[model samples]
Target: MNDQAARLRRMIEDKHPRSDNKSNNIQENSKPEKLSANRGPRTIAITSGKGGVGKTNLTVNLAIALGNMGKRVIIIDADMGMANVDILLGTTSRINLMSLLESDVALEDVLLRGPYGVSYISGGSGMEHAMELTSTERDILFRKLAGCEEWADIILIDTGAGIGGNVLDFISAADEVLLITTPEPTALTDAYAVMKGYSSISDNPNLKLIVNRVIDEPEIREVVGTLSRTAERFLKISVECLGYIYDDQMMIKSVRQQVPVMAGYPESISSRCILSIAKGLLNGHQEKVKLGWRGFLKRIFRS
Candidate 1:
């Protein structure tokens, strides 16, 4: 195998030890098959209760960190109306998802390669137009996305903020959701609003919190603890603390440079935090659900 594939194999072995053949056989036979073998990548939706909580920043950097660890990562800039992922990566896309939906363009044609070999689909204003697509058109879009399953190990959907129908559709379809928030009261409240809204519609949504722009350890604990407690108490949902990003100047500099901090300043505090979160994801700190692209498409198009 090549170096990257070999490294990925080693990481997977270290994280998920081999089970005995007999036990593995028994487990396989005992469980009902839910996901298809063609369902290749794990879909993760990174969203927030409101905008300006650094959702896109975290999404881009986290994808880069995961890619550095030998995982093939694809980021879908699902914020169709106000897509800035291309701007953030300092790369311009000649076409976006809109082109795919409106014409005979293939998925690969719309994908843009960003820094650190990360591939992304810029939604541009196409996402705003997605909700109005006819049934056949929506099915075509989903099938195109499903074709990406073989190319990525992880698909990060950087969804638009707030409790819009499109945002909820993407979040509900994902295997897991990472809710981003800051210590600001409004941010926290909006985050809670998102959780509450989601709980009302979906059953047992996999929700995790990423506290961004934390100034100190105490602030991290305070924000995470308060949000966790509120989610459990009111929504009856258990919110896992994925990780936190510190308030670092390097992040601002990286943004100005239009590069992810993980690529621009690997040693920066925020970059390190993103690496930690990626490790947490790989180490199975959260539950692994069988939901994949096919299931995601079903959920999205049905709604």
Candidate 2:
């Protein structure tokens, strides 16, 4: 843990210097010069301070939203110990991400394609396994994940809540983190705990705040403003407001129907809100350099 932290923290803090055209991490003369695709796919981990704040729901629907915009998306349900994603997606997969560690199945075999060509990979029990992979196993896993750039433009990890090492490893290493929370006092306090856990190791995390189930725009402003101010005051990290989801009954209806609200009812308020957030993320308007999939994976399993 200490070694990976020191290596990754140095990498993170030195990103700007490394982005220069003259300096390169590559030594192979046979390889082509860098292209935009070489920057790799964007990896965003969506998590919250506590459960029941609609984090997984937001993850599935948000993936659909990005897919609708012609972006290839992958949602990895990394919220350990629960299959909420499969239950929500109305999918029951015999092969999961854990299968990769336990067997020789290909990465494509592990993927469950959701709406609009968006793929899903249940973290299954493999999240715990992932955090403790052998060196060879880790190499195989990263090789497969690195291929994601060929097909995917965005990868969203529906991470577990709390300050567990598993959750912290993902959110801390991600290109950006979407910290989901509610206006409730308990939820807000829990949200801060997660942020503190992330800030502990990351040199400077690119975090965005999303307030779910907001009743009104005024409430949105208050919730985001308060959280952002608190983070800046104590953690000394800025949290950007990435928009909010409304308290819509349609979300519940879609869940019961086993379809994402974005796909089931495009006109719903919740769908519109998610689409807006997706657009903000897709347009590259966010003020942060994405750490990419390779970078995210490199920060894992070195403890």
Candidate 3:
């Protein structure tokens, strides 16, 4: 291995030692992080029933916007099969979460930093094993992630489109879930299906809704109302109105520039809406870091 790889490997071995053998290593690494009251972060999963509903976009910008408002934020690209948050943010991550699970790497090693001072975990590929984490590993992962709650104010997980075990597992583990959808009929229908499924579960997630790429206020209310009414009448669950993002080409442009809308085009309506969403989630907000040379180094060299 190269110098950097060797150095990283040394760090891994120091912090989290390798198991007795390859099989044992797989079992040990697959185990989840342990939970402590002092865990470092609060995790929230952002999901959508269908693709092209702007769920990933909302996740990226909301994470950045939250960071701008002074909250320590980390985005977990939990969309296993088709992870692309790094691509959308224009970050070429050298490592990924899956690598950490498969090899002996610190979670920090796989994280990517983004605009507005946000940290993101790239959802890399080639880990079919991740689908079936051991019960011990699952517990260990959660415990370690929960430890993050001790440090981070918000941990946003961007789940893949559709309602599978992988996506559902992320949702179930989160403190809250933000479901995004567009005004299109198909999107609405699929979103409702997802909500219905959640409501049917005996242990459902704390669900919230956001309508993206909206045309106007009426569309926002209408879409939110549809999901709300269905939840009330059918699922018997309450869904909060997180807010909406208007149709703006600037969003696509900002993505092209590898910058969040909040920074790339701050004054845009979409950016304003995202800020409003962060405010609505006010109870979850925390104090921002005092950015300086010390803070910068601390974040870069988190121990």
> lDDT for every model?
0.79, 0.77, 0.66
Candidate with the larger lDDT of 1 and 2: 1
Local accuracy of candidate 1 as per-residue lDDT tens digits, 21-77: 322211332321222333358889999997988989998998888887877788899
Model 2, TM vs. native = 0.84
Error of 2 at 212 (Å): 0.5
When sorted by TM-score, best at the front, the candidate numbers are: 1, 2, 3
Question: Candidate 3 residues 272-302, lDDT tens each?
Answer: 9998998887764444332322121122123
Stretches of candidate 1 off by over 4 Å are 1-39, 285-287
- lDDT of each residue in 184-216, candidate 2, tens digit only: 989999999988888877877788888999999
How many clashes (backbone N, Cα, C below 3 Å) per candidate?
0, 0, 24
For model 2, what is the alpha-carbon lDDT of residue 290? 66
Winner on lDDT between 2 and 3 is 2
Model 2 regions lying over 4 Å from their true place: 1-36, 284-289
Alpha-carbon deviation at 50 in model 1, angstroms? 2.4
Winner on lDDT (1 vs 3): 1
